[model samples]
Target: MLLFDLDNTLFPFRQYWEEANRTTFTSSPLTNGLSYDAFLPLLKMFDEELWPLHVKEAITLNELRVERFIRTMHALGRSVNKEQSQHYFEAFMENLLSSITMDEELRDFLDKLQQSYTLAILTNGKEKEQWRKIIQLNLTSVIPFEHIFISEDIGYDKPDPRAFQHVLKTLNVEARSATYIGDSWTHDIQGSIGVGMNAIWITPRQASSINENLHLSRTIYDIEPCLFHLNRTTTIT
Candidate 1:
């Protein structure tokens, strides 16, 4: 069986993120002559810092989603009204949430894999947001929604052993018989490995110092060799 992460693993997430942000932030009261150049730095800070805070419960996900706009506006010496903030937030999320495009080649690769093994998506994120991307990417066309597991719906996030265990139990597969693939280091690599499952990192990002010893693949289309090794190794064991 193969389990996967949603963002950055299945599609070109950075391109979509840039597209969504540019579209949503360039209009209305949100930008008071705020150059995209100025906006870029704020965007990076908010995502890198706030996300970890959201994960740690320092703030709710909803707060994490919208507060960055408020902070950015404030930093730019502009006072944003609630209505304006709300509009910007809604537009940004709509774009971000709906931005994932299904990779036809990935679907083809998965089609071949499904013929031999069970494939499931075990991603960490809010339920609606995750499901939206799943549908947006047309993932259900190949894998059933029933096989896709989201962290919020499961009441646990990855890197938590229980999260991985739940998916394995639901799939009726032993941990060693399954492999987890994702971009996040803690959540996908160490998390799955910590639970007794091998992991294939959708890389070139070395998530940890130990990454040198871990299985790695550059792009979604570049996973054939990894999949082959995984299959052969499992068969041997």
Candidate 2:
């Protein structure tokens, strides 16, 4: 069995993100002529900074959505009311959802993998948002609907052992028999490892000193060799 992460794993997430931001920023007068290049990092910074609080339940989803925009605008020396922030959020989401599309390369890859493996997606995100993304990408045609697992639906997020365990139990897949593939090191790599499942890390970043020993694939398509080794190792053990 092969399990995968959603964002940045099945698709080129950063590229889509930039496209979404560019569309939204250019269409909005609220941005006050701010360039997408400048707006992207400021908004991304807050999203990353506040995401932990949302995951820990320190803040509600609505609060996280609104606050990120408020902080981004504030950083640019602009005062934004809650209503204005919500407007930005809604517009950005609309643009994002509309801009999301799967390329032929990823589609063909998943199609071929589906022929040989029982594929599943275990991802961390709001249920509605994640499902919309999957649908937008037309994943249902390739991956079974029941195989998609969302953190919100499972009542736990990635990096939580319960989340991984829940999926394994639901699918009746033993830890050793399943291999997880994802981009996040902490959430996908460590989480799967904690459950005794094999994992392939998808990262384009150069290996750092702290992670010199682990093999990393620059793209999801680069995992064929790793998968071969893992399957062989699993069979041997």
Candidate 3:
């Protein structure tokens, strides 16, 4: 069985996320409540200072989305009322979904892998937005819909044992028989390993530092090469 992370694992999430954020700030009503000129600077502050704090505690992606908007508005001297915050958060998320782009090779690889294994997506994002991305990318055409698990739906994010356990239980697979592939060392690799599943670290960025714990599993820059090796080795086994 194969479990995959959605964002940076299958697509260049950071690149597309930055573009989406910019588009939201420019076009969405989320920025209308604040001083438009100061929104970008506030976003920078939220991304650099506030986000890192949340990430360390293994916050759910939905909470992060809401918190980022609330904090950004507060930093910009705007109101942070819960109702208004929710509105902007929804708008911001909708904008982000419209900006997703999948890696071209990912589709082909997933199609092949699906024929031999029970494939699933274990992603940490809002249910609506994550589903939107999956549909937009046509991932459902290859991957089963029931196998998609989003943090918002499960109320648990990666790096948390509960999330990995949920997937194992649902798939009826022992941890040893399942393999997790994701980009983040903290969330994807460390989290999956903690639950006793094999892990593959997809290091898209060249300058990323290796996590000492992931030294035994496969690491690759591209999905095609990793899939090729998995096919060959699993066949041999």
Candidate 4:
């Protein structure tokens, strides 16, 4: 069985997110009349400022999503109430959900992989939202929904060994027998390696995630090379 991350690894999430944000902010009444070109830079700036705070655990995830918009509005000289901000965020989610599109090449690779392996998605996110991606990307057609693991549903997030353990036990596979692939240095690579699973680190920059000289980390620039590597070595079931 193969374990995979959904966002950024399987698809380019930033592209989908940008498209959704443009549509949502343009259509929302709360924004008063800001065009996407004008609004996006502010949103990006706010998002960049909020992320470090989020990583530090200074605010909850809900606050991370809602407060950024509120702060952006305040920065623009428009004050927004929390409820209105939440409504705006929800609308953004709807737009994001609608914009989910699978990468054609990755989809084709997964289609071939499933013929000889049990493919499963092990990712972190809200259950409902993750399901929306699975449905939108047609992931469930290739890998059953039951095999999908979402942190919100499992009550454990990645980098936490418990999350990886749950997926291993559920899939009835040993840590050594399974393989994990994702974009994160901590959550995906370290977490899977801690549990003895082989991990493929996908990064756009292709820099060393752990050390300047990683002894055994399998780093790939994109999923294509990872697919090519896997195809050569895939153990037929």
Q: Candidate 2, residues 1-237: lDDT per residue as tens digits?
A: 888999999887778777777877788888867666777789889999998998789998889989998999888888989999899888878888888876678878989988878889999988998899999888888889988999989998899999999988988898888888899989999998899888888987753222222346788888877776666667311
Candidates 1 and 4: which is better by lDDT? Answer: 1
lDDT of each: 0.79, 0.83, 0.72, 0.77
TM-score of 2: 0.90
TM-score between model 3 and native: 0.73
How far out, in Å, is residue 192 in model 2? 0.9
- Over 4 Å off, model 2: 205-215, 235-237
TM-score, each model?
Answer: 0.90, 0.90, 0.73, 0.82
Estimate the Cα RMSD of every predicted model relative to the unseen true structure: 2.8, 2.9, 4.5, 3.9
lDDT tens digits, residue span 89-182, model 1: 7888788876677778878888887887788999888898888888878888888878999999998888899999999998888988888888
After best superposition, candidate 3 residue 205: deviation in angstroms? 5.4
Candidate 4 regions off by >4 Å? 35-38, 52-58, 101-105, 206-237
Error of 3 at 24 (Å): 2.2
List model 4 lDDT by residue over 1-237, tens digit each: 678888877777778898888888778888767666767788788889998787677987788888888888887878998899999999999998987776566677788878867788899988899888888787877888789999999988898999999998988888766778787989998998899776677765643334211212333234444444544554312
Residues 94-178, model 3: lDDT tens digits = 7777766555676887787777778899999768878888988889878888899999899897888999999989878888667
How big is the positional error of residue 108 in model 4, measured in Å on the Cα after superposition?
2.9
